[model samples]
Target: MAERQDLTCDVAVIGAGTAGISAERAARKAGARTLLIDPWFRGTLCANTGCMPSKLLIAAAHAAHAVRHAPVFGVNPGSLAIDGQAVMARVREERDRFVAFTKETFDDLPEGTAVTGRARFEGPGQLVLEDGRRIASRAIVIATGSEAMIPPPFRDLGPRVLTTETLFEIPDLPERLAVIGGGPIGLEMAQAMGRLGVRVTLFDNSTTLAKARCAAVHDALKEAVSRDLTLRLGCETSAEAVDGGIRIDWTGDDPGRAVFSHVLVATGRPPNLKGLDLDRSGLALDDHGTPVFDRQTMQCGDSAVFIAGDADADVPLLHEASTEGAIAGRNAAAFPDVAPSERNTAFTLTFTDPPVASVGASPEDGTICGRSDYGNQGRARTEARAEGVMSVYADADGRLTGADLCCPGAEHLSHLLAWAIESGATAPQILSMPFYHPTLEEGMKAALREICGKTSQPVPESRDFGNLPGG
Candidate 1:
């Protein structure tokens, strides 16, 4: 029998997904000899099946939808025939290109810096490969990412059921799709499929869509999406196999029995920590079986091991994952010495027709600084998308703190609010900024001005401020 080989590195990063890649790069840049290990080279779930592919599908769907509605703009386009197969093919092709790009980036790393194998922890600061090779490292980073959580009841459905992990690989779009969650992924796919001419029914046990913290935003989203698909919210549901497809029975405000060619489960995603043998590493797990680690440093239980990205099970967005990965990598490379870093203010977005976005803290009973109902906004009326709301929250002192937007340009608006809140910009300060006429941003300006009027603080006079030559 062949003897087991041994390797050594200053830092070992498990999983080559987005977080893993960021961690590895950070470690190497911090002067640590880094080794990255993964079972495949297709990059993270986002590249393979999640963000990229879904966006491609959504873009195509949006194109079809636009052409169908172009008559409103006095530009009458001819008949639109959506070739589902062609759309799927384009999505797959673009998805492969992204995957190849990520793989190439990994391949260009210093030779011998990466290994392709399944790795598991043998003990503290030690890893065992499938081929009997052992690796020793001063510190380790776990960025294994996550997978679609298939509930126990749906395990036996075979190919008839789909999740984000496997949804993009299908050859053709199902004629009837039953989306089993109302979260970001579920809503995105449900609306996209419906736009592409698929019969879609969306089910959610929760009473609200996207779990919007604001009641107005929730109502606007539910009303807007109902125009596309049959939304069954606040439902108790069960499923069973039928000859041609699966039958779903539900009890809700607008529920009944129906059959779908395919069922998509987008309930949630848990950490992917199946075989890493974390118990041997001296790290503790929470009641939910997720590793307990310091959110700021990504360090776990005074050990050299750190956790980040989807494995952390706190923030799952791509941007948050990359940020967490950098923190984990830098701290792991520095070991006994920790680097001081503060997480960015909270920001998240969901891409629907009228996108949903939240920034900084959730709006509570704080003073309402600004508000805009898109239904009356001129820009929205021009774009024929005038059907949502924008709200800004501030403390009693009139400093911007948070916002919730369900409007035509919520994505961009959210970023603006997040930056203002992070920088301690006051309501009057935001209102003092220039807002061009006949634009969607005018709505934001209106909201800001409203809040400024309500604030007890005196508004700064524009004439007293320095004026540029253009002004």
Candidate 2:
């Protein structure tokens, strides 16, 4: 019999997902002897399943849509057929390449760092592996990513009912697909399938889609629905099955029956905190079942231990997960005392046809300055990509509280918004930043200008400002 090994490190990060990997890198950069652990693979959902593969599939669907519809642009490209199985293969190929790329990155990390099998805490600052080995660390980071929130009645997924994770593996595109939940995941999948010539109907339990983003984001998404996707608004799903293909029952206040061939549920996500005994580690859970910790420090219950990413609960997006992971890692290495990083910012992107991106608060979160929409512009039409809008909300002082965008380059544009919010830059300051013309991001600049009541000069940064709008 092999002898059990006991390991020790300055920091131990659990789950090798986006947040986990980021935390590992941040910890090593901070000179902490870090031990990163997960289930063999170094990359989590973003690397293996969630972000990468899904986006690739969407990209393929977009290409197919573009090719078939090129005649509208007078290009005369005709007769397009989608080999969905081949698309899935290509997606898988890309996924494998990305996973390998990440493995290479992980291999380049400094020594004394280790990644092991599934680990469970025996006590505070102590973990036991599946092989009965033990590892000790001064600090811990829980970056375990989230899993699909399977809707009721369809909890047992099969031929007809599918979750986000399983939907990616689908070989055949359904003739009609019904996606429950109007959030980013649901909208993206709905758009992808709809573009691939599937009659896609999306249901938003509430009034809006992508509720976390701005109303303008939904406005843009509505344009996509106008194009192809069918939306069943103000509806809630009761159950689903796959008899002939798929059938879902949804009920609204009005008299109507909604059914489809396939059901994809993307309502929301619950943290992957089940099975793991958090109470044994002295962690407190919030109402959302996420780890309740100091937002600044990522400390759970005590400073000696910490957590990050979806495992922590409320903050679920990739950007939030990475930022929280970095903080947790830094705090773990610099135990007892550490300078707080004011660089806490998040950028969220919904991977749709014209992907929606957002930073800061939503209009629903008690806005100071209300929202405004940048309607369909010539740039989007020219690129054949104009299907969304952009909006932002800020306070009287022009501190950005929220931004929502549904447009091309929304993901990239949202980062700028996040930067402005983090730096306390007002809407005027954002407008002051020079943006190249004929770009989708100009919409964000335009939005800022509309709120600030000024158009920036060609060389705006050179001006000697008397008082900036927010200041």
Candidate 3:
């Protein structure tokens, strides 16, 4: 609590999350003195609450599901017991390990390089902490990350309502859970809870699940998830604290209500710009109170201020956050001469059974699409995972554009497709690449070959960009 402390550095980064750490490293690598400031010491959202913890929960759910469905493969694994306490213990134990690793990064920083306090903009290149400390820097990077949002109806529901952040800390899984939202977090957690023996009812105002853009993949995923939980898609609902738990009331696509032991609000997580006093920073903020920044360069307007990670994006994924953090940090160190960084093709995956994955651009009107059903796929049949579908899209000129998949091994398929898209591989060129027989990847090849057959466009002898396969 040094009331008269004043510090100066070439770059000042707020929030020691993934983006902030990356920014600090990049700034230092660029030979600029940098200071990282954060009040919380837990870790990045991915390690603590967002990605790793949730995936751990999903892993437990997958195990339970496999036991229940073992009869289909003629292997009776016997009755399954989901020890809720043990599951959560392992989740926290492992989660803390991830958090500890992140904490090490900050702890290893040189003396005076990290500060623990909240800060506000005093003016351009100047910041004042609530502790009466001042910081003057050549440039600044905002990487404050995001937090889960709860609507008015659920905000007052007391401990009965939880967010992805709080859900992991609970002692045990609820006997009955009401999950509100059909987005990735909502759907993934809902199915996991259901598979773990919780009576889960998922409600979303939109009928579309997981933002499935391709209709075939949408239907396939919807069908698969329906078996795992109560899906009340296209339902408008509100909650009230009641006896035993909370009650949900709705009258949209569905006209019914129910009460649950607990409610999870997964509607959204806007950037955590609260209390930063952004108005004093001389930045233009949209109606959402987010700073208008150049997403390509991670620069705010043409100023020395840069914004990265969840705080700067409407769609914040971990990989993109990491990418932006590096870009913003480098530019912040080399201010007034910012340049846009190269970005990879878009890729997303919902970690569910028969997980949904999308890569590159989504299909547009008149885009030629080739599809296949896993119900007839050779490897799928052998694995008894015949409950999904996939599609790969191309333009009339016949270059690979993108893909939508809701099938077994989708995580792998989407990655290969993303690389193909990045490599600028065409349908025929991808087909020409050897696909081992009777594997799930053959399903991808099936869709791609179908695209080649459906069009009379001459096959490209080479679309490898520079990496000619088997050359």
Candidate 4:
């Protein structure tokens, strides 16, 4: 390591989050010298905000919810108690532990591997740091990730408005929560908070819940979630700071006004592209200022520049980000002779009680559909959790393409279907695999049977494979 203000490297990566770290490691493994830079190297957004902390809150809420519903199963569980302080305390402490693990990655880096500053693109292969240091590299990888957006309406309300980045830091649960936006973040946070005894109203301009494209999934999820929170879907909303809290007014099918202690804006997380001076990079950018790039190679217009993760805004999951990073890093190490990486079957999950999920390709015209309604399902009815739908899609050739699921075990079922689709399995092939008796997975099997009946050939008939709709 030298004390030179101007440093040279084979690859320079910006923002040491999930994508950046993976890219740096991949570049190094490809026999290229790499340097990683960020203003604060304090782990990824998942460890700090998005995934882990939200799950901590959801876990607490689900525990409370289970206790309240114990009487339905004839369990004599006593009155439930939700200690807000203790709940948030455990969340923050456990979150810090996970963050500590991520921070250790930086500690393990060899000398001069990481730089502590934000970077601006000077050209295709050059960067200038905030402290006036210059970095010359053969290739540059942009893995800056993203930030939670605050829309115009919620901007001036100050501390009462919370995004994922600031939600976990709240001292206590809100007296009344106005969750704006019905995307995955909104649904999970609103339902979790409501179940934990907060008065929650989930608002969205569209009637869709969890952004479900399939009408069956949308209806089932909406009906189930309405049990916990007030849903004000398809409404135009406005807000302002009142004397003690925030006042929100809505106009639509039902016009109304209400005051809430706080608002959780879960609209979406747009890519973080500000302050990069990307115009200086001389790469073509879209109307949104995002650089034009190939998703398979993660390259920016055949130049020595690559983008991955939320910076590219293709697939925002951590695993997808890691994949993109590996692709970008390997290609950056061998610029102009880069190879394309194969992508995985896509899936996204929203952790509601009966989770909402979509896996693989979306259904289109001419696609055959198969359905399993969980309302009368054997395992669902036996567990008293029967209240959703699963819609599976297939090609005209009988091969599985995708599925939309809103059911008790949608997350697990989504994984199974994603694997089936990735393997290019037909519905009949998946049905040949054993499905256990009286389990949520049996519900998935039922759906495959429906697909079997619709496809070119049916899955071999099993004698009452648990339960059919009329069985």
Candidate 5:
């Protein structure tokens, strides 16, 4: 072995992904010397594989869907042809640009701030790089990120099996696809492929689509996406290598067997802790094998170590990961005397046709709320995409608690609710806000009106307010 070299920093952040980047910036902003280490320096999973590329493909798929359904608008475009190869190429081109931007951002970090090598724990506050370099730090943040999890049984299926990591790299779209795990990633990819003319069969062990907390949203999502693809929910599934492809077998109320050219597994993500050797760090692991970290401070137990992003398992969305990273980084830099950061309201979205969005606190038993079906909403009907529902929930005190939306413009609606809930807005206040006529936002207003009626708070009467200054 070569002689070991030693370096010291105020903070050391593992992984150069989004979380790692945010952590580094936060630590540096706190006047601490920060070092970021990773073997590969692609920006993040979102820019490279998860969010950006998937949306590009979804955009192309939506274009194809729109042309095919143009008759509703009294416009007939004839013989719409979809070139899968061209679409994939365009997605790659745009994805590469995003990846390049991430790389550039990393490169622009302050000089001597980053190292390119795999790092493992040598001891508490110590890291050993692959080539015999050692780093001593006052604090450590594990933002090592995660990898797409393929169940053990399907690991040996070779190239026919794909994950978010590999799915975007395919040169051409497959004739048929078997998507396992009907979560956001699975559903998004399944619908995109189906809309792009690929035969897609989606399998989920869970009975509900997207595991929606609201039954109305769950039913609406099932109704909307099931129109484009075959969904086999609430099933136990198995797969085997076939002659030219793969065979998927499932047992349930909708049990069946099918062969597909490719199988995309969006089951879950496991933290990339294989080589970090957390056992040497003296931090306790949770039931999921992740380091025990406070959600508020992002600190691992009471140690000088921190965990963030997908590594925590509890916070998986990109924005949440970034938030955790910022918190962990700041706390790591100020350990033993740090002010804890308050977590934002829970917000998540699935990018489908009508989209699926959930925000703020989850609905619980005895929770009274309001519901609106977009099928009856004017905007959705006018757009010929009237197939979803929206629900807004408020506590007995009339404060907005949460919302679930499986409707057109659900993304925007979720943001609105997240802001309101975080700001402690009441249902009556939300109802009093202006809702323009014949817009998707009117659907939100309709739900708010129902919630307003359920609350003990009196709806504002026009006469209750004073006249304008001019009057």
Candidate 6:
């Protein structure tokens, strides 16, 4: 028996996470009859669990590290202690306040709109909820984001074997921890926990952190790792439960095992595409179970049906996901004959200590033209904040391709690089500008000097400035 209920809307958005919410709001503001759906009554990960909470904890860890190291600068601080529980409590409270504010924005949608439930496609223009209700729309968007992937051996993520999803729930600080995977999540958590007095062992199948980043980033991050972390690179793990904690078993030349108080699997994430009954709508899923969609416009199968966020098969981040969702929302309601805006301009920041942030091509994808140090070596030494590297990539003709940073002012530096990459700022364009001396951004100038074939005046190596030397 074909059960059918009539529903209609100008736009239907699924998964009200960052991307979904942005798209929903934009669609509604454009005078479209919009309906948005999500399972989290309180809200999605960015609202409750992902970016917001994780960054708060990372920031707290940074503060704790700075205070503990104050004595080295002749500022003696007696008895520095990290109350992990208190810090986590503050994170939760802040998260609650943010979620409440988000709810207000979502709740104020104009009347004659709104639906809250698990929405799945029933047909080309129809959706069925778990509660047996149905709605039809001119367009449907699947913005459902991603979920953490746990391989079979790690299925039992008990207290000690944790994923990012459960990492923040620990009641006490771990004495020693092993973080598996060296991507953004792993590197960020490894650096954060290591700063908070946890002996962090970072295990990665690959030798480099964020292989997508430029090669120079590995050398810069290796310097930071030299300070607070144990880098167990180029090792694949065979995990097993043990007495005090779990032991990560691995084999390479000089193979060994290490036991830690806890193990965090920051491996990677997969699309949360299950249970949507995608086949019910005659939609095809790729082998990995992500929705197949037009990469440029994010439109899946029929032009009227679209998907965004982690489920879109390429590019996943709270920042990217939301932007993609907004585009999908606009494109879904757009006339089929009209072209969408140029495919999304995106940015990503890895919130590690002396955080590594980048935009555009991975080092492997482009040519590295210039490099400079922020903290220990060059101008940053004079500025008393030597902490990171600024490296840029360009095409053979000197057009901007990508850039990476690991330093004190990386957040601000990333903003400028983002603009450069997005605005098609040629290498010469950036090189032409004279930066203020003794500032962190001088690293950018040094890098530009290298690209422009100008010899960089080397800063003396004798001056430590307390910033560690290169890897």
Question: Using lDDT as the measure, which candidate wins?
Answer: 4
Candidates in order have lDDT scores of 0.86, 0.72, 0.87, 0.88, 0.86, 0.73
Query: Candidate 5 at 78: error in angstroms?
Result: 0.6
- As a TM-score, model 2 comes out at 0.86
Question: What global local distance difference test value does model 6 have?
Answer: 0.73
Residue 26 alpha-carbon offset, candidate 2, angstroms: 2.7
**What tens digits encode model 6's per-residue C-alpha lDDT throughout 1-471?**
776455578888888777788778767766678888777646666767677878887888878887886776778788888887888777778877777877786677767455767987777667888878787677888888878877766668467888877777777778899888888888888888888888998887787886536666667777876677888788777887888888788765557888888988888888887888877777767887666787667777665788788777587777777677777877777736324556534567877766778777767774756777665655455434576677787776666777877876787888888888888877567655555545566557657656655323333334312232321
Task: Find the 10 residues in a row with the least total lDDT in model 6.
Answer: 462-471
The candidate that wins on TM-score is 4
* Candidate no. 5 TM-score: 0.96
The sequence of per-residue lDDT tens digits that candidate 1 reaches over residues 1-471 is 878668799989998998999999999999999999999867888889888999999999899989998999999999999998999999999999998888888868899988899899898778999898999899999999998897865678879899988888788889999999999999999999999999999988888788687878878888888888988888988888899998999997766898899999999999999899887866788997778999899988788999889988999999999998999999999997976689998898888888998787776755564777888787788888888998888887789888888998888878888999999999778767776656777677656656767876665576222232111
Which should have the higher TM-score, number 2 or number 4?
A: 4
Model 3 per-residue lDDT tens digits across residues 247-282: 999767558978899999999889999988888888
Instruction: Report the poorest 10 consecutive residues by lDDT, candidate 5.
Output: 462-471
Measured against the true structure, the TM-scores of the candidates, in listed sequence, are 0.95, 0.86, 0.95, 0.97, 0.96, 0.89
Worst 10 residues of 1 by lDDT: 462-471
lDDT value, candidate 5, whole model: 0.86
Off by over 4 Å in 5: 1-4, 463-471
